[model samples]
Target: MTTEPFLAPVTTPAERREWILRLLTGTQRVDRIRRLRESIILSLLFLSALISVATTIGIIYTLSIETFHFFQRVSLIDFLTDTQWTPLFTEKHFGIWPLLTATLLVSAIAMLVALPLGLLAAIGLSEYASPRLASIVKPILEILAGVPTVVYGYFALLFVTPLLKRFIPQLEVFNALSAGLVMGIMILPLVASLSEDAMRAVPQSLREGAYALGATKLEVVWRVVVPSSLSGIVAASILAISRAIGETMIVAIAMGQVPRLTLNPLVAMETMTAYIVQVSLGDTPHGSLEYQTIFAVGTALFLITMVLNLLSYRFLQRFREVYE
Candidate 1:
């Protein structure tokens, strides 16, 4: 009977070393490819971040240069203290107070309408509504945010203003009240969605603990969930306020372009964004004082938003609750 011969294994140290070297070479190739891929991904991420930083720096530089030119032509004291803001008229007055007061007035009214309603909606969604109901309602509510600002502006001008005029005969055709109310509705989703997300992020263990202490659902939500999520709530409110401040189309179309330094919500007034819109309508000369006014106003709006963001960051840092 013929038997097949068995192949011998590598017995020498040199043969074993060669096999190990081959294995290591393959592993090294795989590792090099993986590292190359990772490096490409990291570089893309860095480039994206660099683009955002560059865009912000460019905007700041442009605004600073134009604002400097503006200050050279106009006095800083008059810009801050002057109550009139007619740069278009033959008698140009550049007092920024009128626009500033109107912007604040409209934004305040918007917050008055939005804050309580948004908070209540968030509470209802997070604590009361079933998951099915929340899923259905949230998308529908966010639809309002998806609606174009120009459409909201027209809705305010055509529908809301007419309705309000019937109830309040003293209301102007173009008034801050309608504009502010519409702006509030426009930003409501931002507040509600953000606040609900924060509330939902509260740990279930915390809720169970509260329940173990015989606390009701309402009690647990208010006493535990809300305090835990206070930073997010404040952040949402500040973001909504910033949105209202920067709103251009709604204030331009419905709030009127009249820069009046009055707190009365029933009267026509102009916000900073609306004034910028009015100036940008191609009627003003490119290098004129009227042209430079938009940049100056934009600088002020940017500063205000930046300050609000800084305040929000500080508030979040101070009150943020971390959970394992």
Candidate 2:
């Protein structure tokens, strides 16, 4: 049986013209309503995108204004050159390098631990594990992402430092090594999740082609899948490093407040974020140089993270694979 039309063809010419006119009018009304809805949705999305850009501009302005004030009182030369960072002390050394060094040291340690483990985990989950196994393990591993940074700090100071002390007797109670190692663990989930998504996005045909050429699973993954996904992997690594650099509580609690220009991970050190937290916690008078110190450190932190993001975007563009 065939479905009947809502309106049968009219026998009269005048009736047919009337029916055609009504249909066209109804269609036009529907098209107008659809266009109006699309315009509203598009405008809302454009406004939403502007919010982030506006927020970033506001942050840059705030940091720049305060940092300018800080540099007026404290010489830029001293801030860059001096060995010690004793801004709150009676002697008042304004060297920024010590805190920067500590920040880099911790970030370096975190990457060292996170990159290899996270990449390997991503590879295993994407290439080797069964779908069911990958589904179970990925979520379990990502549970680390939800764990609070404060908890990680407590764990570092209470558990990790002591654990390291057993093997390295010289480890300080509040040290960079424990803090960095814990930060690495905190970053692992982010790296692994992003990387696994990237690798999984690769076309299955590429893998099949490799197999037809007698390439083993390992060879296909390393040579084809990994190279195709290199952009995403690098992006994930950059994001993880930026997260490590901006982390405050974990480094503050575990890495101590001493601003020493030393590379020794076994000793106590201070990061830019840790120093900012310390100043914020204290009752430093508003408009004073000590108070302004937070803004200056924040400026530096913002610039570093921004550079990393830019670099990530550059890498993504450079190695992006356009699969047909």
Q: CA lDDT of 215 in candidate 2? A: 99
* Candidate 1 lowest-lDDT run of ten: 1-10
Error of 2 at 252 (Å): 0.6
Q: In lDDT terms, how accurate is model 1?
A: 0.90
In candidate 1, the residue pairs with backbone N, CA or C atoms under 3 Å apart (3 or more residues apart, or in different chains) clash, namely none
Which one is best on TM-score? 1
Residue-level lDDT of model 2, residues 231-260, one tens digit each, is: 889999998999999999999999999999
Model 2 segments more than 4 A misplaced:
1-45, 317-321
- Backbone clash numbers for all candidates listed: 0, 0
Q: What C-alpha lDDT values do all the predictions have?
A: 0.90, 0.92
